[model samples]
Target: MSSRERVLAAVAGIAAVAAAVAAPGAAATGRHQDWDETAYRGQIEVVRSDDGPSDPTVLNGTVFVDRDRDSRHDRNERGVAGVEVSNGREVVTTDRRGRYRLPVYDNMTVFVTQPAGYQVPVDEFNVAQFHYNHLPAGSPELRYGGISPTGPIPDAVNFPLVESSLTDDRRLSCIIAGDLQTYNLTEVEYARKGAIADLARRNDYQGCGSLFVGDVVGDDLSLYDEVKGLSAQTNGPARFLPGNHDLDFDATTAVHSFDTFRAQLAPAYFSYDVGEAHIIALNTVRYPCTPDLDNVDGLRPGCNDPVNRPRYNGHIDETQMEWLRRDLAKVDRDKLIVIAGHIGLLNWADEGSAIHQVDQVREVYELLHGRKAVALAGHSHSIENMRTGDAMQGWRDLFGIDSLPFPHITVGAIAGDWFSGRVTEDGYPTAIQRDGGRPGVLTLDLADSSFQERFTVTGENDRVQTQLGLNTPTYREWYVARSAWNSNPVGAAPELGDPLVVDQADLAGGTWLTTNFFIGGTGSTVTVRLNNHRPRQAVRTQPMRGEDQFVGPEWSDPAAVAEQLVHGGSVANRTMHLWRFELPTDLAPGTHQAHVTATDVHGRRFADTLTFQVVAQR
Candidate 1:
């Protein structure tokens, strides 16, 4: 069968399974029993009083050295001084007694900025318990049970820490996974075999550990346990940040929106230090979204207009900005700052959107002035490595970012394309991404303050960097035909005619070799050599500087499209890292090998080889 027919057949075969798995009743029992409809049933407008006591509420906390490794401050435990703490807005250091007092308000999360040479106590699920949520009245009535009102402010809320050698070394490796987003148990299995299994076999990241960049589950707060179980399989501590999907949609107020998440995971946003890197996890998602015509969800009459209903948007509130300013002021300017969040500060996939990109990117840039910095995000499922000086007109016009100050990467998802496509022998889904990239996790290997990033494709090694294909008229015809077939119901299966066999007519018509470098970016290079000939540079298909997106076969990676179009997933439309080179028409017909080498912006290189037959005619 042709590619389109295969995709349709696959969909038809799984239609009943999808229906049974997605049935409303299926989600109402077992792990999903706690998923209340009130949380997402209707909208409720949240109002708060601006008025407060004239006197600041002094909340005291002790950062004690847990000699016993327990998460409690025993009578014999000694306080460790000089550690920094925050009440989500103001930053203060512990006194000589390792005691800190910060003004607290209702709905404030006071957390310690984990210091190097010390480890914060982890909960049973390995979630760091360094923060104390001080919501006096707890969360308002909603589903997914938000924070229970902590009644009144306590006199003391102490955090326990133990000395550790994990973060004392100069070398650090961190695993960054994006969007586990398992809507059901089957998808969870896909994750176990995919990135989680890869992480379990590795011993590299003992200090920095793994940070899942949001979307831990698909709105079902009950699934947090299953997700946590998956994290337990990893070799190191697993940290999580909240995504738009992690929100308690029935929340009536912004303060209580992420209560369930904070309770199950870590605080909404926090910071820590390991070696020379200071990691800042920010809560960049703003919910109960104010009405915006630019909202990507396409909600009727906008988010704020229809009041009471909660909608999410990518924005950094003033309080978080204040916290960031205070947090960075205490850090050494020479240390590398790694800022991570759910939604990206800026991305190429949603180039024309303000909702996907942070609203205060310029302000964020100014805050990190004179410091070495890099950002990691994952709301867009595509893989993007945006180097400094990479400029897109949309980013410039929307966020006033003339050029990237540092690398801003969108890590590919662990649940690639939401775990779609056929299952593989490895017990995972072949969920190819919208950009035609495979599922993977990104690793930031750090030596002191400097670092380099590499993407490890799930079930594959680091060497599998580039995908090769031939961009000929036959492939282009198949592309158009397949696109039309997937969109309409009556079209026949898309046949590529013969992708492997290239004719003299194809060579005469100027067919080219295509390379899809998964982690490649601007300043990167791709070179191709055929039959031991001299190496030739392959030009990038789309230059990221101020241009509209170039899509279609001429701009796509044929190797990826070949699998994605046939397997039932997103088509590889446009990629910033794709490169192409024209093939010679004078060569004699024979089987040939093309050796491809790809070098990233940091001078790291990966190599792969592709073999194809050259024939005069079919």
Candidate 2:
């Protein structure tokens, strides 16, 4: 209760303020941890501001409504009439000055969708030009993966714009292909002949352009030139991302994984817009092997420059993350965002390997929230049609069926199995599966935000080729009887080049079987039935194996197309010993039937029937 006590209190306050300033995540003037994590509508931010009334909320800057990137708002380049802008969630729009304002958060992205008939500036390789965030201490680096801390929203969020007519056309389309992992020149030729042939012919996709997800080539980087040559055959622009195999093996640092990739294939991580969609291509691989024993190739002491030689794994570094945050901020929530890369966000196989998994996968999901999106990838040479919301915990299980907030598809290989061994009649390898199924490609038809997908094999063209059949009880007995007759081994090697066929059904478990029905006529439908009924009841119903496995679109013979278009007659179905349908349950010892009917895209029908005997139930 005296002058001495008051003086001591003032001095104590000063000491407390100095201590707070010395600590991390703290500001001056002893404002404590009072941070505003709310939404804001500015593009510039200030960190380490002194607390008290002196703490300025907005940074000193100007948000000019430059309808052009020339730093001048021209008459014709006037601001769009009424487009909604946002700070991730809360929305606002520009006034006559073509500007907006809202609350600010620690880290934020403020962007605008260019109104139709107008445009925005693009960077050197044509990436859309925009501005955000001036982080002081540089962006934060990730351990396994992720971007830097956002810090705080900037002061002025200004968007630039331009004008163009192609903004609102109906017939726009984009081609998405994956894993052109060509190991040799021959395999590269196979890719060029098979996949490139289809692209050269499709004029409908000229404007939409094409994106090759990853593995531009096998580990051999020399094949890149050949791959790009093939890509140039298409009538659209080609964009690429590097897969694990596309790394520059000679480099000795963390950034070299994509230096050559970026030199040839645009920005390793970037974004572009086309027809109501925002496409984000991310560079998930972090390169440069370190002294840490956990590195894949392990300590490359011979190569030691971080900039020249990069080492990496499944990851997104600080630089790319900062760009992504700014990029996503510029995009409107309602618009569709297509995240395309070589590695999938969710996969079933090799789930634990850091080499294949994205460490910050969960954090990226949190950033996007529940906006309309789809993720596409190709590293594993398999096709997976996975819906969102599925648990992707392990690698052995197929995560294809689980529902998700967005659909994710892992497209089949361009050179199925490195064009494996010998070339087939189609000028490509017969690349039979180690797992199962022939080669194929995926086709996605997008309408605005909604889209449909179909898998088309290089030689076969049809929406559905799966044939599910039931096993008769007698057939079950035969399946079991065959096992006993196996004096040697159950899986004795069959003749080379013979189609992998199962004649004797294994009653222990029912397995899905498949038949490749390459029908090439109009008015035709391919249907499978038991006996005379279109829907014959089998003792056991099994799905067709490799039914939807397709690697490329149908490479049709123009002569065949012309002939079939007019004549419209049924061709005898070639049974290549592709699949064997199993009869379910125990059928009374007697004769049973198997049949198939084909109805082409033109609506004509063709049918075939075969019969087999049932001994007894297994």
Candidate 3:
């Protein structure tokens, strides 16, 4: 018998909707009964109304065939039939041609659960190609996220079949890339030259996949196809989400703000499993500008009326929130939960900035409780690993500052600063910020319930870049004041480069600049020696922002500042203008640090340092 007839004959005795509920731990919805019900009268139709043949020879419908047996299309797959088909709310089967259709709406997903015995095609990299796009004419110019607006859907949503398997434990791995907001092709090239090259060389990822959190291209949706081509550089499947710059300017409503994104990228809010973690990528940019949108305290309408709306801000709306709840429900409690988005939660690096806030971060955080969770995000073009234990533990700590609760890492941009300025040896901007983070991508290895984070610098060195000394309260006031006048005071750092000659007078009473370096390596020992030391003094405060005022454990001088001022608190404006250190020779074969001070071109002084290190074994 023919494939269609064979399939029908095989299930002809079966009911139209199988009564078998999916087994626990299976998570996947099983067979639909409609496959054998040839007597049923509901028709499967394809309606394409453009200036084409009245009787177009082909009916194009996007199909997502079940490949991994996970009941969801992971990547690279288009749906097909010989498989059971359903709209979730309705049931149907593919025609004798292995194609089927039920009523499709602007936002509906026409899916096919992978049949028990067929394989879905995969690319050269082994990534699954399992989902097809079904966009009929008269559908809104932009109806769903990632739909290509440049052309209409083709004649037929075809599925290239391979072999099939029933085993679901494929050791899935999804590559998570931070921001790549390339405003132009040049920036895209920068990304290609940098970590994109690195990704191309990697194939060990579980699921052998990659998902870019957001800012795929700097405010330009037109560059997506080129970005996709760059993604082909990788050895696995790739997916993407919408960032602030990916907004749909032509969208008539806020609901459609991510339309172009959906057409070109993956769903704005979707989930897939890799290893033991359920990774969900979200679109935090709620567009369709709203008037009362100046980083307000409680705003919910930002995602509803993006057009004619006031200012655009960052947030997760009710629709997405409800979806998140449903998505999380499907995940097992024992699995690690990883939530990746373009905007970070509680990012102090861009403190006081509204555009980078996740209006509903706390709500999402609550949903993933009791499960091992890590929130990975980007938008600031910087990398920070923040943790809170006490207050951040929620009501237990009253949301006050305590120990880090969980790690919240903000990944540096793949297209650092929109591929800022001149290109370096790597064909991209040396885009190393004075704050110490070099432009790069972050690699997270998750196994079971644990993960390790690695920041891969763009160029050859894989330098472990980090910020050294931030302004103490005294210096903070100075930097703040000078920064108001000089847009780049941080660049004009004071040059206290020379080693200090500790003398009796210097020891009597003096305050020194402290350096806080991040991304240090193993076996690294930070050592210090004064050219002279009548008083052996070194107080290295913990390396942190907004709180680097004290010296190391070696120093215990409370009056250093007061004595130096010759007047108590009156010297509030007095900043720490002098200090220095050298990179320890014993640092492990990785990144290291050396905090120092310096005087600017003018008489004014500023405190800053360096974040450098020895290379580690690849």
By TM-score rank, best first, the candidates go 1, 3, 2
Query: What is candidate 2's CA lDDT for residue 60?
Result: 27
Give the per-residue lDDT digits (tens) of candidate 3, residues 249-299: 666656667767665555566555554666677778766656454334443
* lDDT top scorer: 1
lDDT of 2 by residue, 1-618 (tens): 443343344334433433333211101222112211210112222224334223235432223344324544445545554554444334455566565665554534344444544444443222233434323232233221122343444444456554443334433456677788888867766775566655544444433456777888877765655665565454444667778777766554454445455444545665666666777777776666343522434323422444465545566766566667766876779777888778877543334355565645666777788788888777766555555543333422332322245666666667655566457686877553222234555555456665555555545443433332333322333333433444345564222111122233433344222233332211223445866656532211112121322211111111121222222221111121123344443433556666765443435444555454544332
Candidate 3 versus the native: TM-score? 0.60
What ranges in model 1 sit over 4 Å off?
1-56, 292-310
Residue 76 lDDT, candidate 3, scale 0-100: 54
lDDT (Cα, tens digit) per residue for candidate 1, span 1-618? 653354344334333333343221101123111111101111111112345323348877788887765456778988889899998989999998898889878778888888988777654444556777778777777677778776666657787777767676687788889999988867877887667767655657766778899998988887777787676555455788999999988876566678999877888988999999999998888776765533544522345642555567787888899999999999999899999999999988887777788877889999997899999999889899999888888887776677799999999999989888889998998998888788989988889999998888887777788888898888888888888887884856877865777988888887889888999999999999988899999999878887767877788888878888888888887887788988898867999888899999889888888888888886
Measured with C-alpha atoms, the lDDT of residue 519 in candidate 3 is 33
Best candidate according to TM-score: 1
User: Whole-model lDDT, candidate 3?
Assistant: 0.48
- Local error of candidate 2 at residue 330 (angstroms): 1.0
Better of 1 and 3 by TM-score: 1
Model 3, residue 396: C-alpha shift (Å)? 13
